[model samples]
Target: MDESWASTIAQVVSQEYPAAMHHVQHGPGHADPRELHPAFWGSYDWHSCVHMLCSAVKLHGRDSDLGLSALLDQRLTPYNIAAEADYLREHPLYERPYGWAWAMQLVKVCRDTRWEDALAPLEAQLEHNIAAWLRTQQWPVRHGVHSNSALALLLIFDASPRMRPLVERTALDWFGAERAYPHEWEVSGHDFVSNGLAEAALMRRVLPESEFDAWLQDFFAPEAYTFYTAPIQVNDPEDGQQAHLIGLMLTRAWLLREIGKPDGTQQLIDAAAAHLTGTNFMATHWLITYALLAEDALGN
Candidate 1:
């Protein structure tokens, strides 16, 4: 990663606080965002905060900058993480699949066991939720955002190993027989994730390499893959929902890289570069993490 990008990520994760906090008063007392999630109260919302933290930690691992390390330590205190865990206990459904996935990813990135211990409460809550969801969810959610079960399972499998069997079972049960996905029904104005691509990414993790390749061949027609290689247009980057197209670009790059299909790599890279050319506050606050994730997937 470039030094400038790393610096920007550190700055945003550390200083971009106090906007886009989704706090709802559940009872007589109203809690502030910071009060509810002391460690993860920045970067627009809880899920973003968690993923941004994950990005910062990941970048620090690659760069080994003292300043970045200090910033992480300053913000990721045991007290603050405990407060975050407590908030999850209070509002179990808050950012259910999205935040829960990122929280587990955050745990995966934290090198310190102390940080892991601090995050135990939140981890426990998310694990419980995942198990419950697997048992009850009869159908997979196809949306690209928070509700996408495949996306959540992929994250869980990445971050939490114990949940692998359940995630694999649930994913295969929901998506094993899927074929000829409808590519035309995509790029919903607010979609940040490609449901079809996400499912392929998740299947890659659960199935053997040969099986996944066969499954991929059966699941997406060549035209559908070609359609995804072209980036979706973002009519208005300033519009928070429309800005999600940038995320879709990043995620597409990630999926392409993970699938290792050389045909689409350059197109995915080009699309990602185009979407990343400009920035808006709404997108800047959270989109870089997805960009970094794509780069990671591509071994950059």
Candidate 2:
């Protein structure tokens, strides 16, 4: 990997923070900064802006942008958490499956920043929303694109001993039905379904070993790889962090390493790293994090 990868990420993040914040302060909710030209609504939101900033921290291992960091740190308070919960409580897309995922992400960010009290209402809201989804009269569970993503994070990151059973049960319930394969192919014009499945593999890695291992094998088998749709080119304009296809691939690669399958793991990582580099997608911060983790995992 080129040494400049980390710096590239930092530069993009450094540019994005101010731009995102400016839009958040002035633009409508759900607006994304990338869509600012035609005044497209819902391009980004506070949640997305915050997620990007958090991604920066994850990449750089430092909160170098104190102003942006301070803004997010303060915004994730109990009051703000309650407000977000209440807002999501009323909106289905924002409420159940979707809300659960973003809430989990937010919780992780808060935890990273030591915002302990913020988790209380956030957890309550997540449980309430998830329970409501469970009780919905629908026969076969139909999780929306965004909601499943959120719920998957909960499965991956739920660290509470008391919550393990609940988490597993939820996972089983969500994945219970034989998925006919995800149908949504484009989000921002990137291959959304396969990317989601890839992320699911990582999420399950921390689940019950037997179950997770089985699912991982199914997702990573040669048949699946050959049959799977490749994401649109990195610069396809519609593609954003879908470029972090590397994150998904690396996450899967690490799972393989955990299972003593290092050969294919290296191959996947190299492929992902190359894709990210050719398209200028993976940033420096992420490359560094990925490299360090991969090296540490293999003890190389």
Candidate 3:
């Protein structure tokens, strides 16, 4: 793996985040995760953009640079400042006192910088979010991916000492449950890639690595992809349209890479890049992640 690949993507993702946030302003001064540039609107849609930005910045190695630290400071504050006053009291439908992006950005930033000072307030919000998650018995929480993904981060965060056990228990419960709400829509009878990746990462963090390894094989089985509905053929020449396919393919590809299967990983990356290139949905976050992964595959 090219170590610099992570940094390159980090820079590209960082460059776009501020502009993407600018387009989605929701409240008096808040940005909506929905509205992006016209052409890139479908390409880098709101949720995808936010997810990609969070994921890319979370890439582990690049967080220590003073330059990157300053960039994060620029985007993190005012990006969230607009909602500070009303965050808990009168936030939007999906907006929360502790949003998935907010938590993700904070935790990831904390991974490298003593920016521990910057994250002090965010730690309180994460604590609140944990309580909010535990208090509910609802299968799929109010927000779409936000709740599950945010919960996953509670454990992923290196700083959350108290949260480790709770996240472990919650993840095990989700995995052991007889039925799930299905995060994957393309698959008629399956969950989405976003959900798969979230749960997979959670399992890896909470369980023994060997057990996690077994689960990865079962989830990425070829038969499972065939049964999947929407993203069955991500790069089907017939329709030649469908950006969401990248999410499913890349998730599986990344899973392979995690286990050190470079061959399988590169195949999926190639397929996803073919679909994304020159597509209108270029602005989506999945594409960004895909691009970074592809760059890595190319030894960039």
Candidate 4:
């Protein structure tokens, strides 16, 4: 809840364009990132751009600053949103679940119906993608990165209430029976989400409180939670992949707090604070959003 931290993040979200970029070329004619994604061509990558937009919108809502509101309005104009929708129409699978989830989060955070109306086409396409993905996917993605199905579903659950039943059903089908995940194999050096913890977090949101508590007890042994209480070591904060451990810490903090575990919360907070000191361009570009998310989870 630091105003300065929020302002710093807002500055990055608003002004960092044509940023230290990275993308995958699906085909030719994919020239500039800005041309490919009019509304989300900043903050280094597509998903980050989308979430940073969400962050800015949410921050403005909390802070109620005219300048911040105008900044978001300028960037999320009807024309820009329509162009983003067009891009999604042409390339539905461009960022898949990650970018799609953040796009939905963007819609969820917008207070104006104009922004929602502008993003309708993109939202519809994302919904279509979710349904199609559910029907075709026989198994859930267990990775700790953007490809994780549970993480995407969690975002979708917040963004689209109509999608909730389907998402919950799919989650129960995919992870309901899972238990005793191998925690020793974690800290994968490049993990933004803890696969095991992310699934637990999603289930906590979808299931009844008592049911979720029982499920957590069954799914994760006491030692598993204890194992994650310690901070993950990042040998190279400058390396984008290794820097993901910072996100892992912040995410774990939020997830743990959400699930009513307080002991691990401070540990994760301290860990995230320590990691923040060593942040480089790789982590600085996107980690602030995760840190804010953690703060929100902690009710700071």
Encode model 1's per-residue lDDT on 106-154: one tens digit a residue: 8888746345666666677778877876788789888878788888888
Ranking by lDDT: 1, 4, 3, 2
Mark the 10 consecutive residues where model 2 has the least summed lDDT: 36-45
For model 2, what is the error of residue 121's alpha carbon versus the real structure, in angstroms, after optimal superposition? 2.2
Better of 2 and 4 by TM-score: 4
Displacement of residue 288 (Cα, Å) in model 2 is 11
Model number with the top lDDT: 1
Which residue segments of model 4 deviate by more than 4 Å?
Answer: 14-30, 112-114, 274-279
Question: What are the Cα lDDT values of the candidates?
Answer: 0.77, 0.44, 0.44, 0.76
Total clashes for model 2: 13
Q: Model 2: per-residue lDDT, tens digit, 131-231? A: 56655534332232333442343433443334445555655565533343442432333222234343454345445777666666554554444333332
Pitting candidate 1 against candidate 2, the one with the higher TM-score is 1
Model 1, residue 257: C-alpha shift (Å): 1.3
RMSD of each: 2.3, 7.4, 7.2, 2.5
The sequence of per-residue lDDT tens digits that candidate 3 reaches over residues 1-300 is 224434443444434433433233445765443222211122123344334434445554444442344544554453343333234323233333224334544455455554445545545555665557555744533232334453344334434666667656766775643233333443322222455544554566666778766766665554433333222454433231344455456655654344444454555666555543333333233455545543443441
**Over the stretch 151-210, how does candidate 4's per-residue lDDT look in tens digits?**
888888878987899999998998888877777777676888888887888898888889
